[model samples]
Target: MLRIAVPNKGSLSEPAVQLLKEAGYSQRRDGRALVHVDERNDVEFFYLRPRDVAVYVGQGIVDVGITGRDLLIDSGAPAIEHLELGFGGSTFRYAAPAGVAASVQDIHGKRVATSYPRLVTEHLAQFGVEADVVRLDGAVESSVRLGVADVVADVVSTGTTLRAAGLDIFGDPILKSEAVLIRDERSDAEKIAVLTGRLRGVLTARRFVLVDYDVPGDRLEEAIAVSPGFEAPTVTPLHGSDWQAVRVMVPRADINDIMDRLYAVGARAILATELLAVRV
Candidate 1:
């Protein structure tokens, strides 16, 4: 059985669970259940703290896991990113009291606080600055005002928390973060392949939809040129002989624009539907 770890709480947890469900993995069958078993695939899911996910996966206690990119970097875990899941996106940055004169170089020889010590340390190293890294689990922004640390390295979603703490972002970003599927280096090849395939299918389904419509034979070439499918549009002769039925797969984001273009080109009866998955 393949083992996977998922966040049990925090910003990335719910969306991670929903994405897994959409990928045909059931979760929350019983309230408060921390582990879920996928009967069809002999897979086991371990619901763990967000910070611990990368540690478990990196240690090979679990074959794979989902966690924020920031958390992964903070954990300093050796794991390969299997896929960027594209949710819970944010950035790691330095923040200081509003109106304070602070720059990346200003922190040299000063104390900095952060939940992500490893990421902060590495980032600071690149700037040739030696600052004491104060590791705090939460309320990192308060460290600046309290004078416990000169600056803080933390995740910024909308900069709301930073502003509420009377802090402003400074310098270039330390790291850009998003949810990612990752696997341990020691994971078996077969399991890795299976997991990657399933994740790819889910990712593909999220980005695209099936589009079907009818057009005159003369317009077939134009329609194909306008909205080509993954490879080519599916075309079949219609009863009128001069008409053809066309079906294609298009990115969901491009659907509206493509549909308008198709309409302008004389296509009719256009329909669009979500895709569950696309296996290549």
Candidate 2:
């Protein structure tokens, strides 16, 4: 059985589970359950803290895992990134009391608090600035207000938490984070192939939807040109001789606009449906 690690808490967990479930894997039934078996695929799921996912995969205790890019890099674990899952978007940045100097170089010899000590240390090192890194698991933004650190290196999603703490972000971002799929370097070829194929199908389906419609026979070429699928649009003759049925894949975000254009071009009976998975 293939073992996969998934986040147990925080912003990335629910979405990660949903994606896996949509891909036909069952997450652990009990909230506190650490391990689960998906009888259909014969795969094991391991619920883990986000920060520890990369470490577990790196050690080959799990074949693959889902985690934030920031946590994976911060853990400094030896693993290979397999895919960027396109969710849990955020940035790792330096934030200090508002009106402080605006660059990492200004924090030389200062103290920085963060849960990601390795990422902070490496980022600051690039600027030739040496700051003492005080590690904290949470409440990183509050450290600056309490004088425990001169600045805080933390994940900023909306900048709301930082602003509420009276801190302002400075310097270029240390790293941009999103959910990613990662695999152990030592994973077997069969496991790698199976997981990669399933994940690609899931990711592709997440970005697109299946669209079907009817159009006049004369307008078929124009409609096909606009509504091209991953390869080619599927077309079938309608009951009426002068009409045809068209089915294609369209990007999820462009559905409305594309539908409007197709309508203006004589498309009718348009329908949009969710895709379970798409492989090309």
lDDT of each residue in 15-60, candidate 1, tens digit only: 9988888777778676478998988877899999999999999899
Best by TM-score: 2
Candidate 2, residue 240: how far the Cα is off, in Å: 4.8
- Taking all chains together, the TM-score of candidate 1 against the true structure is 0.94
Candidate 2 per-residue C-alpha lDDT over 197-265 given as tens digits, one digit per residue, 9 for 90 to 100? 887899899889999999999999888877887788989998747899999999999999889989999
lDDT of candidate 2 at residue 98, scale 0 to 100: 69
Report every candidate's CA lDDT.
0.88, 0.90
Q: Return the clash pairs for model 1, or none.
A: none
Error of 2 at 65 (Å): 1.0
Leading candidate by lDDT? 2
How far residue 175's Cα lies from its native spot in candidate 2, in Å, is 0.9
The parts of candidate 2 lying over 4 Å away from their true place are: none
